[model samples]
Target chain A: MKKLHYSELWCSSPRYWGGLAALTFIILLGMAAAYYMEHSGHWVTGMSNQVVWGLPHVFAIFLIVAASGALNVASIGSVFGGPLYKPLGRFSGLLAIGLLAGGLVVLLLDLGRPERLIVAITHYNFKSIFAWNIILYTGFFTIVGIYLWAMIDRKAQKFYQVTGFAAFFWRLALTTGTGSIFGFLVAREAYDAAIMAPMFIIMSFSYGLAFFIITLMSAYWWASRELGSHRLEKLKNLLGVFVGAVLYFSLVYHLTNLYITQHHGIERFILLDGGVYTVMFWLGQITIGGIIPLFMLYSPAFSDNRFAIAIASVMVLIGGFVQIYVIVIGGQAFPMNLFPGKEVVSSSFFDGVVAAYTPSLAEGVLGLAGIAIAMTLVAVGARMLKVLPESLEDPEQGTA
Target chain B: MSGNREQPKEIKRREFIGMTVLAAGAASVAPGILLTVAHATAEAEGASSEVRWGLLIDSNKCAESCNACVDACNRENGIDLLQRPQGQGDEMWDAQRPQWIRKVKLKDNQTGEVTNLPMMCQHCEFPPCVDVCPTAASFKRADGIVLVDRHTCIGCRYCMMACPYKARSFIHQNVEQQTLRSPRGKGCVESCNLCVHRIDAGATTTACQDACDKDGHQAILFGDLRDPESALSKALREKSSRQIRADLELNTGVRYTSL
Candidate 1:
């Protein structure tokens, strides 16, 4: 593949056309859902007070983390001076912006007082994690955008140098803020652990790397089939490493929780006794998210396959949904105030003393609707803004 | 700067009128604005900060048949039966129930049995609801009563997540949950105020406490916690009282003794 510019790839290809169409369809559906939710006043969605946040909250966080991860492609290679890793830099930055915007869309839809969201900026509650999250997310998005554009602008060379280092820390802080929203909720015994904040950070790394690796490996195909193959191997190896880390962190997180008897009951309620939630945690996260991806990544024959990496990315993403669910929904399922008394541990699971929640269809659809909106917007963005680069071919070192 | 001050006398008359209007605006907003925390403190001109308010209810003295406290609270708050949130049953448990008073069956360790007692907001010293509230709607007074602003409440119910007692309730669907009063709407959070409205009128106790007295059992006591002479404070000094879910570390105003 010869050295290429943005115009060459902007020309429509089968992959681009299909991707754009699918994305547009999803976004249109999301807009429809949002309209439905607004008129329905939240009752249209399955969300109840018991399960206050469902798919939208989890997916929004996922997109944010993924967005940060996408930025890592550029920030890592550029700011950290990854000389060999420089080839994929701008692509990462562009993807980062797209994903962040998607995350924001989902988040706004979930907010109880949507119109007053801006009002959140004016009325700051020092202790409120939700308020802090709004600032962190917006700030991170702006910095990532400026840093990326600075990379392209030959006129302003010095700005990139400052943003180069600043962007990495800014992204990290964004993920940290996201985690603290749940981690600092001392009242929710499930999320009370300090480890959760850091665990969530690690999750961002896993999801980010897995997503960026798959996207990069796939995008490289635009240059030619041969170019993507070599890059695919590099990404496959990186993903293997990331999967191992995700598994190790997940094990440590739960094991440490179990090491103490105090958390054992709730932990068991999640991992063991927590029926549907437990199955989803184990199957969606542990098996598909961890074991299957881990096994496939390790198997050279399978890991090298382009199809396999895509499958793994999808699996890992789905697994992330379960990971968040086990914490947020699983946490709420347990009685909110567990400071025990002669509390009747309700003999029946649903009827038990512990609070139980099941997502209604409205709840589930609203979540799906959020995803559709994000995909559609990103697709349209790629089309309108020329966010997708013209070339996937990497020029030799020092080539203008 | 010196010349401006001399010229201000001519303009001062206009400015004074403007200032008066601003003060009037402040006065109107102040009672409504300082609502989250100030109700208890606002009434405390005669009282002091050291004077904490607490409640003591003896379950043995409480008769299960009588719920005069519930009736009194409902009547006082103008909470009609319709506006009430689903209690422990309906889907959304974001603290929407507004009877403010409740009859719960808590276990008795000595008898190994469930005992019936009326319950309401504990009004904790370190109110979690206030801290997580995005708006300053949920707040605690210096005198230790936790209160909510009905007008400012966006009804996000983040406070519901924070409260250990699960004392707060959301007005799900609409305010018509209360049949007798003005419809408050679906999205506002309402809870036991410790009857701040009556307190402003110089009432010695809440409607619930007064109703309890009328019931003849004298099972409940409400008073200033600082004055040792108050029945509640004296009872606290005498009998060991336990707040519901004591492990939560909330310095709750609600206390009940085992039979």
Candidate 2:
């Protein structure tokens, strides 16, 4: 087998490398900000008491789901035996495993006491959604490890069939557990509904597809030189469906919250109020993450172009973060008890009652660090593992 | 320690068997939040089997004239003034703060409908805070009382998040300023310990309970939820008491009978 090689194209390709560099730079700034926050204190950032766990947590959770999801190769190969996808199989497992590792790093960095994360692991809190997530991440990582090793370690294919399925289902269960952490909060009224868990799974699928498609497309652009239109189209179409799923699920989730509980004042306050977060939810998540990607990909002209597909993929990443931010942060901003007194009027959403929380600069940077760390890992993995095929047999133009 | 992690060793058969046992043990524990910390605590060997502490609040008699419980609790626990008022950046946790408990008046009907509800931790039997606490820092004693262990609390504020009564508060700053009894200040969640310090000392009741214990006309009751023979439990049978937020299904330890 030919050892994988990095093309000069990777460095020269303004589109892919440029985006990668920009993402890296953004993440670097975030890292510096995070370090400062950790050294100084949470006060250095925008996070007030109202919105305690802000951007970093939201971004981390989004990254987590995305990381868990970016393992589509394991899902398709282990679940359905998609031999066409076999080349990408072990590599997908690597991405899934890598992204999760990165996500955990960002989350820990965001904590006021990173030292306690291990304490958290050793101590265990079956009741806290956050504690269970620690276990969930650990378990999910294990399954991916076994599955990836079985795929790549040569003497392992025979064992991997069992291992791959384990990894696939465990990742599914892990993501659901992650979702349930938010969903089971009967106290957090916004997060209590059944919709969130399934929404997470669907998001995993969409984000997983987006990540791989962009990565594979970048690799294909150089080594294969094939511009494999039909295959690329098929991949785009599949991604398009997940994007559609994201759109549909988001619409249903928000509308259901709005429609069923329209009279429920606090819920309505979140969905409609001039709260910046509410706007972000409606605009950034519902519009940018869901609709724009769908519009771009669902259209034939846009879907066919590799550049367009890549852009749509980027949108998926952004939109996913926005959506999670809305849930994790917005859920906290509302006072759970809803005590009415002479101080604040009944049925009024903004009677100096709204909890205020904003992610400090450190929180934002640390969040960025998560993304940077992911991209760096992917880049290194691509370079070292030779996961991307350095050669393609034939080529066809997109115009064909 | 910070870089790429080596591949985890594959689970050996022995480890698998061990994990299975652990999983089984974990499964036996209730699916709610308390399982996380059950091991950390020993079953308190208090004289159990007959102490049902209950509270009877005469809503008809509640006049917000005196907030003695807040004062007594503040003095007892060394809670700060929380001077910024509710919804501000003041870091201390106390009973009178917006995030914790407070007394308030509500009027309806335009003409009349005035009443006072001295609200605080209801200390539910099936505490949602206890159920959802990931670290299991928010613990319910074997005697049906809830207590927060300040040291173990990770400050995820999930208890604050899970609490239906809005009873818990997150210490925003390092709470070095504490009274001699339980000096917890920053980054941990605190609520009405229901005066646990007083209870453990074999006192008749908590400070608030004692303060409400006005001239034999009782306002707050403190006894074991497990005890059926206690006067508080006896009054529970006689008076139609209501919980602060029963809809949460926490099965609160403290019952309130509106007078």
Candidate 3:
């Protein structure tokens, strides 16, 4: 194979500074919104006792799950030994770290007492899935950091596979931990299942790959560089397979829930009368996120169309967000069955009623800030380091 | 390091008497307001696991219109004084406010039988809230009173999510003049600590029990599970009572009859 050349995006352009400036502004806005919510109290937001987590969690979790998936490129190159994917490894590692940092920032800021973050770190309850996740998340950063060094630095190149393999397993555990955050909740009918963990793994694969493809295309296009169709087709096919896997897992989750009499209520709510959640599941996750992407990727007419593949990737990302909203918010909206057969004739705390949540402007801005922060890190990292490769042409067909 | 060169003289007899009078006057004016002290004193003897505290309620005798226990709990915990934000509606504020206890009305599906009961923290032997709390802020005392340590609580509200009975409440807004008994603040999860202050002070009963007795309901009973002679234990032995969501096998301290 021909040797791959890597270089930084030129930093002198007006567009580069302009984009960075825009990202900085959004980060500041998000910080300000966080301060307003903290100072005025959570009462200003639409979130209540009923729905403890809101849009911020949805954004944070989606980015975190995608972060785990983003490292797949490096895993394929170093662990699985895919020659075409090896050149994209460095940037993939960078994107994974940047996305995780962004997600963590959003999650920490959304806390009721963000200042007590130190307490959460210090006070470890081993039984809690959340405490274990804290270790997994931090460990992921360290392992991925070493993995990146192994891939980039020539002297440390020998350790690439060792570190990559370790990272591969760590990221899987991290995603499983994330999925179990919901799965372990026996109180909520929607999440108490073993399928949630594996479903999350499948989702990470699809969402992470989608995010990686989009970032690669956008960065290359902006720099006026050629991202070869040969490489794009390989990524396109992998993304299609992951998306199909996600659909299969989702189908299994619903089918399994449907089979059980206890879970019938939650299944009905999501598949039928959950209103926005139902729309998000069918249109956002299934149609736009899954079915359409599969069609565009596999169809003979659009098989080679790079634009169609990119569009599919974007759809998957949108679908990923919709899926999270449905899981996090929709699950909470359904009332807990405190009394099995009896109806709650009256309750002081809006019991036995569907809880309503409207995302406020502050929450919306905070969610955007998470996206902007991730993109900014990616933008700055690309400009500063020799991450992106010159081309992905095979040695036999160098002219192509 | 050995600075015993000049020992200071003690205060004069007149100064001592004047200081004593001043302290007495201050104590009289404040009545139970020792601002620095927590209600549940950090006494040398911590709560004992041997003595399991619980509440027994006979819901059949619980008057439908009477919310004495709810009112008493609110007053004792300062939940009543919590103010709604300026623009929010009454219904919105009511739905969002911290509720330590509440009156719930339930109707059966088949028999169309109706019942009313005051519900609070079940104080389970194996609390899901305590189990899920990442910071260990939501903890069960040795005496089986599940309470939130506001000092350490990061207010993630995972406890609220884990609770099956909807017992825990998140403090949504800051309160100015909180009662000394329950100095609640914003950004923390809290629930009925089973009147831990009273329990710790050796009061032998709770405000809700007192209020119920005063209202002539005699529906609520409070005592220790370890002591078989306790009124609560005797009532449980005599009456056919059930724990809410007994299928979970949480072994709740609170039991209700005629539900």
Candidate 4:
């Protein structure tokens, strides 16, 4: 095998400057949006007592889940001994940290009392899965940071495998903690299933890989790097498998819910009657996010086409967002079964009726800003550090 | 003879002055002694684990049109004073405002028999809100009243999501005006605290129960569940009461009869 060489992203290019400027603009806008929401209170937003978590949560959760998945590439290289993936570890580590930072920023800013974050850190209720998640998330950064150091530092190279193993397990725990945030909620019918944890893990795999692919492609394309078709093919194929796994989990989740008589109402709401949620499930998640991407990745006609592969990855991301939206927002929309055998005829509270939510401009801006922040971090890291491999070109015959 | 008269007058005057001073001292000390005794009595009545506070409601006695309990709770908790922020839509404001208690009318699916009752935080022995709170801000008092510590509440809303009865409400807007008893603010999760201030003050009843009695329905009865001779315990023994969502086995402090 050829010896690997790494280089920093060229910062002198006009395109680089332009991209940085755009990301900075978006980040500024997001900050403003956050400030507006914080100052005016949540009443200014579409979120109400019924739909307490809105668009910001969807974005925050997506980024957090995806952050763990982004590290999968590094884990595969260092832990599993995938030779081709080894060289990509540095960038993968950078991307993972970037995604997590972006996600955490959004989550913190969206809190009702964001100023009192110190209380959250100091006070912990051991029984709460949320409290556990705070530890998991912070631990992820520490572990991944060490893993990245192991990859980059020549002196620390010997510890790569050990750090990789730790980071791998830590990422799994992080994703599990994220999933349990929903799974442990016994009050909601849509959540509270053991399957939620595994499903979220699968979702992270798909979303993280999709994000990694798009970022890799965009960065290489911009920097005039020789990214070989073989590497692209391998990554896209893996993405397809993750997508298929997600679809399988989705099927099992719904099927299991359907079998239980108690869950029939929630199942029916998501599958058949829930207007926006049902449409998002079938049209956005299953078709656009799942089936089409699988087709693009597996089919002979589209698999080789880089543009098609990119589109497929984008679709997977869109589907992932829709899936989370359905889970978070749609789950809350279904009114709780206060009276199992009784129909709520009237109440001052919006009982027995679906809660309504419309994403406000500020919410949308804030969500997009998280993505911009993640991209900015990756961009800046690449520019400053020798994270990216010099080239991913296929070796000539007999070169090894 | 003049000196002797003067000396007698001085002694009489001195005696009168001393008697008046003693009277004033006793009068001042008496109220202080009485107040200390009252304070001690109040302290003795402080929330105790032995006395489990709970509410027992008779659905049959709840009048459908009378919203006295909910209205009274709003007044008592200062929930009625929350004003809609300027530019907030009426519908949105209605959904965002904090509601400690609300009247709910349920129709039995099989029998078509309608039942009217008030719904609020049940103050479960094992409250899911308390269990899910990351900061332990949502906690059950020693006497079984579940409350959110506003200072520590990060306003994650996880507690609201965990609650089964839709009992909790998030304060979405800045609360400029709040009752001294409630002390609510924006960005914190709140629910029915079962009129804990009244309970702490040694009041035997809640605002909801008081209003229900004034309305002559007398649907709500507040008392110590531990007290066997209390009116709530006696009524519970006479009537078969069931907790909402008893299947969850939460062992709720609030129980409803004729539902």
Candidate 5:
């Protein structure tokens, strides 16, 4: 490609200010919810000893995972030298940073003592994966920040490959760390699988690409700029492959569990009798998140249609939330079988019963706030910086 | 100018010999001030390595419907009186309450035999809670008591998720006027510490064990597992006691008899 010209997205438009206002309002509301939950204690929320992590975690985790995946476009461009993806690289890096910042905000706010986050930073517990993740998350920001800078600065352009590669590997570690947060949980039958790590990586890839494609299409549309069908095709095809990979992992994970006699009860709970979770698995995660997206991306009828692709991206996002919900809350709902053969008839705590959790309105606001915060960052940053490309219209001038 | 006055001192041989003697004298007394060594079967002013504090519960002696231990534990830990929103339903408050110990009535399908046990933190030698704690707040004492250090606990509750026994409870509400020994608070995960405060204060057993004995059940026995002559150890040797979920190989400090 010839030298691509970048410009700041105009900030004066009513559409821009309106979007910013809406996002800020939601963010403030979320902050208030967090304060209430913190001050009044977690009892106000539906979260109990059983379902320790609630709705906010679902959104925070999804965003964090999606953040790592968002950088894949830049990785393909800079790390693998994908000519078609090079123009999208700057926007991809910015999105990754924005998404991470948003996710971290929700997570920190949800902490038992949000003020004592300094302890999490200063204390070293190498044995815990959570401690390792803190390093990975902070390191990701520094590495990706440098990677973004390298892409933008003419003097630092030569070092793009090094920084880009570092960011790529860092993101992989970040997602893997995120997955292992559940996977390392040996006590929970639902989370003790090794596949969670790779599954999350693939999940990140699909969710990230879906997010990127949607944002790319809409941002260009809002600017009244042309985004070629060729660029869309590249992203669409890659998204299908990722979605398929996730399905394969999900299949193997269940199959592996089915093979083990010890795991039969958990499998039965998740696949068959686990009412809400079962429906979520089949309808939300598999059918909506997985199958529909695959059909949209690969089907000849919908392949060329931008609207279909957009719908599929949104479906994948919806599915991503349900999938995380199943993994986190569903896993907790299944009671721990402290006594293998003997059935626990009664207990002071709700033992041997599927724990109940209904996400409170406060939690809902907090979760949506995370998404709004991410969008706001993207909106403000795009307006102030030379992030978005001028156009992807001229094929003759394009690297592809 | 500041360095010139301090840097010029050179010690003579006699003065150096005198200084060395004084240093040796300080070193000799330092161990007494800073160090406390282990003594067998005796309280040597700190938790001892020679004693592995453990609990032995006789399921046969425990009544199937009894909750004395649970109630005692609740009273001792200030868990029973934890503040909640007024007018909250009993079921809602029960679910929200922090339970350090609970009466579990288990029925064996194969033999049609029923077992009654009070379940709490097993205080494992290699506790998964301790392993997964991000801040090392969920820690095991030198004497094998697993307790949450409230000061350091971040309330992430990853330890609660990691616990196989479901022994840990997260305080989901703001607390006030907690028991003198256990300072209760919201967001932090807590579990039975075998009444470490009582043990440290020279009490021979935990609150639950004392409650059970007072109730005339004599099901719960607390003693040193490391000492072969200890009642807990003797009971283990004489009776077939098993750890719940022994397949995990946690080597728990809490053992059950006649299960």
Candidate 6:
């Protein structure tokens, strides 16, 4: 091993400016969509009284969960003493912060009254998990910020392990808080299970690592830097394990629901009868998001192909988003069981029937904006700070 | 000296007559004064914890065709005045519109018996809406009436998700006109407050209860559950009544019989 050198991203290229401008345009479009929704009301969106949370939540929750997982590389370096991961720690922290900011912005702008954000900040019910999450999200920023500082500043290196440990636990708690948001909903049949917390944690691991790998490869490629095959192989392998864990949790979640007679109807709906939900669960989530990525990463035929790895990572993100959609939207789409044995023949409130939701164009733009915001942040951070290593070439190749 | 003594005697006689007249006047007005003061005190105190306002609904008596309670609730809350925004579809508008109360028809799976009832907020003692509200905007009054403070509600709709009864409605469009009693607006979650304005105005009856009585059904009974001597309490004592989803043990302020 040789001494590592880090530098700011080279910004003189036309590609850098083009990417920034594109991200800016998307962000502006998102803002306009948000303004339209706010000006008209929630009626503009496909969300109704039945499906209170919609597509925006799907994107928002994905980013937030992935944000915690983005810090894994840094944790592996400082907390677990992995020297190979050390050079990646600074960029990990930067990505984590960027992702969180993007998620929070989408969440804020989608509010029925975004201006009353101060009310949400100042007033809190301690009993509510939502209030607890607000605190957890804020604390994550502070702790991760300190961890990034420790890794960057030479004088602060002594506190690296302490900050790393704090960041690690805080991210775990943050993901738990996000999962518990649904788990604690006693009224909704799809979300009452206690398994939601651990499931979300595993989900974060897969989604975050997948995102990290894609971004890392893109950055290195753009910089014309040599990223060794060994590092890529290591990341893809870790991603496979995380994806497998997510699948295991999904199996347990569905199996547990299947065993309980009470959850039979909802299980049947998601697995068989639910039109869009079933397709998304099997095709988008399980097959595309889970199985395909695993095959691409582990298959010997595609071992040397960088394109296959990138595609697998992209697929993982797509699958993760669909998984969230099934959870957030599909869960709400199922009618609540107000009467156990009695069937609802008539009701003004759309009871005993599946609620319909179709994501509007405004919602789509707003969700895309969150991704653009995150990418923009990472790009800006890389350009301004020495967060990226000069090269990840093998020490045996004399380019370390 | 004699003239002075005579003046004093006259004064004493005069004082005695005045005292008797004053005593008579005080006796005549004292009851009225006491009643006025008591009425004022009740109004000043607002909703009291000692009095748990509740509703006793007789589902057996509720007519399948009659929507008196729903109509009354809408009219009273100014929900009827809300107009759908331009270019909005009827199906979407129906889903988005606010409904404080609505009729629900249920048939027994095994017995094949039909039942008609009006569904609204159960006003639970341990309201899940209040529990899940991050801003504490969804709160229960001391008198057991659950309410949403529009001023503080960020319209996050967590309360809507938390509500088991499907009783809450989010205001989706701009409310151009609303009754002063309800003061509703866009971007807020609201539900049946059980006509809190009427309760505070010293009215013992709710709009639904009044409408039910007028329609010759008398299916709804509004009273103070704490007052055992009240009609609602006596009815509960004589006939068996159960709260909806009693297994949750929320001890809902609303109860139904002959379901």
Report the lDDT tens digits of candidate 4 across residue range A1-400.
6678888888457899899999999999999999999898899899988998999999999999999999999999988988778888999999999999999999988999999999999999999999999999899989888888888889998888899999999999999999999998887899979999989999999999999999999999889898988888989999999999999999999999999999999999999999999999999999999999999999999857999999999999999999999999999999988898999999888899899999899998999999999999999999888899889997665552
Q: For residues B62-123, could you state the per-residue lDDT of candidate 3 as single tens digits?
A: 88899899999989999888887899877668767988888989999999999988889999
TM-score of 3: 0.94
lDDT of each: 0.67, 0.67, 0.89, 0.92, 0.88, 0.92
Name the 10 consecutive residues with the lowest summed lDDT in model 3 chain A. A391-400
lDDT (Cα, tens digit) per residue for candidate 2, span B130-198: 777777878877666677876677666556656665566555443335576755744566777776656
**Model 1 C-alpha lDDT per residue in residues A303-322, reported as the tens digit of each score:** 55768878887788788778
Off by over 4 Å in 1: A1-4, A7-25, A43-45, A214-227, A337-341, A345-352, A384-400, B1-50, B63-75, B78-102, B108-111, B150-155, B176-183
State candidate 2's TM-score. 0.80
Q: Any residue pairs clashing in model 5, and if so which?
A: A1-A399
In model 6, which runs have C-alpha deviations exceeding 4 angstroms?
A397-400, B1-43
Write down the C-alpha DockQ for each prediction.
0.18, 0.14, 0.71, 0.66, 0.53, 0.60
Estimate, for each residue in B1-259, the C-alpha lDDT of model 4 and write its tens digit: 9999899899999999999999999999999999989877887766789989999999999999999998999999999988889988877877888888888999999999999999999999999999889999999989999999999999889998899898889988888899989989789999999898888877999999999999899999999999999999999999999999898789999999999
Score residue A262 of candidate 3 by CA lDDT. 81
Report the C-alpha displacement of residue A10, candidate 2, in angstroms.
8.6
Query: Chain A TM-score of each model, in the order shown?
Result: 0.88, 0.85, 0.97, 0.98, 0.98, 0.98
Q: Residue A91: error of model 5 in Å?
A: 1.0
Chain B TM-scores per candidate, in order, are 0.72, 0.70, 0.85, 0.84, 0.81, 0.83
| TM per prediction | 0.83, 0.80, 0.94, 0.94, 0.92, 0.93
Is model 3 an incorrect, acceptable, medium or high docking prediction? medium
**DockQ score for candidate 2:** 0.14
What RMSD does each model have against the real structure?
8.6, 13.7, 4.5, 5.8, 8.3, 8.5
Writing each residue's lDDT as its tens digit, candidate 6 over B139-171 gives 999999999999999988999998999899998
| Model 5 stretches astray by more than 4 angstroms | A397-399, B1-44
